[model samples]
Target: MTSRHLLWSALGAAAILILIGGGWLWSLPPAPSVTPPLPIAQAERDATIAALKPPKRQRPLIAIIGINDATETTDYLMPYGILKRADVADVVTLATKPGPVTLFPVLKVEPQATTAEFDAQHPDGADYVIVPAMSRDDDPAALQWIRNQAARGAIVVGVCAGAKVVGDAGLLHGKRATTHWYSVKEIRGKHPTLRYVEDRRFVVDDRVATTTGISASMPISLTLIEAIAGRDKARAVGRDIGLPDWDARHESDEFTFTRPFALTAIGNTAAFWARERLGIELKDGVDEVSLALAADAWSRTYRSRAVTFAATADARQSRGGLRIHPEQVASDWPAERLLPSVADRRPADVLDETLHAITARYGARTTDFVAMQMEYPRNRAAQ
Candidate 1:
């Protein structure tokens, strides 16, 4: 063919390809309707709660494990903060190896112990091992440590995509579980023997427990509180945290990559040059749960990423005693870039407020994308 004819043919093929791709994107299912989550049966709740009860001890030992390189902010911190607030367990933050763990979408933290240190201190193993979503699911140190703890009779609780860590450790084989809505398809394909339940924020099968997504951390933490102490104690703690109820109820199907969500993500991500670094000024006694939610939500909005800044480079202790390392000095970012103060706000309220802020800044569709990523039921409350 002549060069002109070849050029024309290539242009026609490109146009056809664009049309086909657009058609498929349009045909993908939209977000599911918002509905009240189906209630978990009382009998099931009782059984599940009972299943997590620790062996007799003065205070049950709980270990929250993460990789030193990177871990999901909310997944690692929320549970630690909540459990410490409850004062029902001896909670220790652990890293796969020594050094501070860099939390994604937000801050960093100095783990109370490394897996090696934990083994030395508590040779008998902890009553519960809390696995947060790490940067990689196949870290050898993490998998082996979890297996050791599980074999030693610890109830393993996997938060969000931490379910994959549990699954990768060969713990969820033939067990019932659930994980982050976005991870379900891939996780299911990887661990085909496990039953992936739906419409549930958390699931428990034998000694292995798994939760839905980042936001599910709050509810799962409360659930663990109940398992360790009692219903009354869990109720009080839940109220203190601004979540009066911590049931395993969730509308999982509602969170998906819809057309609007895709458009917002694509547009926001494509405008990389326009992206901003949003600052969250840190201080001693900051509420870890709220900080996590605020930082996490804002960072997910494609338009910006959250950076924890403080007066000094030293780590500041959160209200519950988790030490958060600041990413930058306060003077590095201008006043307009700092997020509004979230002092005294509960985690759930912080999330709602952040979502509203995201809507105001990037539009409602971007806010929806952030919420969907969290697997949080945002539309119901908004409606």
Candidate 2:
């Protein structure tokens, strides 16, 4: 073909292709139209979002630590419930690495995120880091993390004997603290430098908050919730949980917290710490906010039971919410009554007694761990 002919042919083919393509485009069903996201003024939107969400609830992050004396899962969970239910903080579990962390004899909780997984660039940075007491005697990695948390300007609070770990990190050097009365000896044995009001349930020193022990977890959590949220919210949640904090009447040395025994003298400090740290408030009760009222309709019914008041032997019946006979408590168990006030003994005395008894009975659990850690470096003095 001649060059001009070839050019004409190519032009005609191109025209045909264009026409065909155009026809195909026109023939197809109109693509479902997607409304474009409105041109959001980045700065304005950011400002609006900031204002809509109360700044306190957006505390970036809060960590529930794991390590020795952490058997207090309820301590961690109750505060977690307040934080999440109230939505005052981004709660995450921070472990040495990132896996299931065994808590005491019963539970194994996996960390929500690891220390390394924590992104510094996250839009919300952590503002509060809570170190929970572990059941294990010690965990060096978790201790180091606590030191790191303190360095990051995060508010630090220790629940139950977890305070000992914090104190061991030297965070509570001059700070006042309290732990289980049963641990008063070991705590003193482990941290003499830490000031303690053996009777106090919880204590806050500047940026550091410490609890007496497991018993004090709830009260501390409530305190934290109120500090960050508000009294109305805190009270609402207290009522919902049947916290018995109504008149501060929950005070006193001898109120049975739950099924199992605890680490603190009275109030559950972990709960109090969460209450103070994250201001979550949901007022629910046996009435409108019953436990039966699940996110769905298939849940079971519930009750807002009050703490049972213990009555001494024939000490005249007093009118109260729920009365629990002393016999129903330790009074009925002859063995418990005769079990001796061994708790009244000192740590050193107890340790010596334990060692002697163990040596006479089944010997130490294992000698290897003792050899490796015992001589490594203990503060010798509890402080």
Q: Which candidate is the best by TM-score?
A: 1
Query: Cα deviation of 74 in candidate 2 (Å)?
Result: 1.8
**Model 1, span 1-383: residue lDDT tens:** 22222111233244345445778657656766657676678999999898889854658999999887778889998999889999999999999888898887668899999999999999999999999887778889999999999999899999999999999999999999999877899899999999999888899999999999888888888888888888999889888878886688787668775667666666776687989999888889999989999998898877898898988888999998888888987655687787987788877778888999999988988888888777787744321
TM-score for each model = 0.91, 0.49
| Model 1 residue 194 CA deviation in Å | 0.4
List ranges where model 2 is wrong by over 4 Å.
1-60, 67-71, 119-125, 244-383
| Collision count for each candidate, in order | 0, 49
Tell me the spans in candidate 1 whose CA falls farther than 4 Å from its real position: 1-22, 33-37, 56-58, 379-383
The worst-scoring run of ten residues by lDDT in candidate 1 lies at: 1-10
TM-score for candidate 1: 0.91
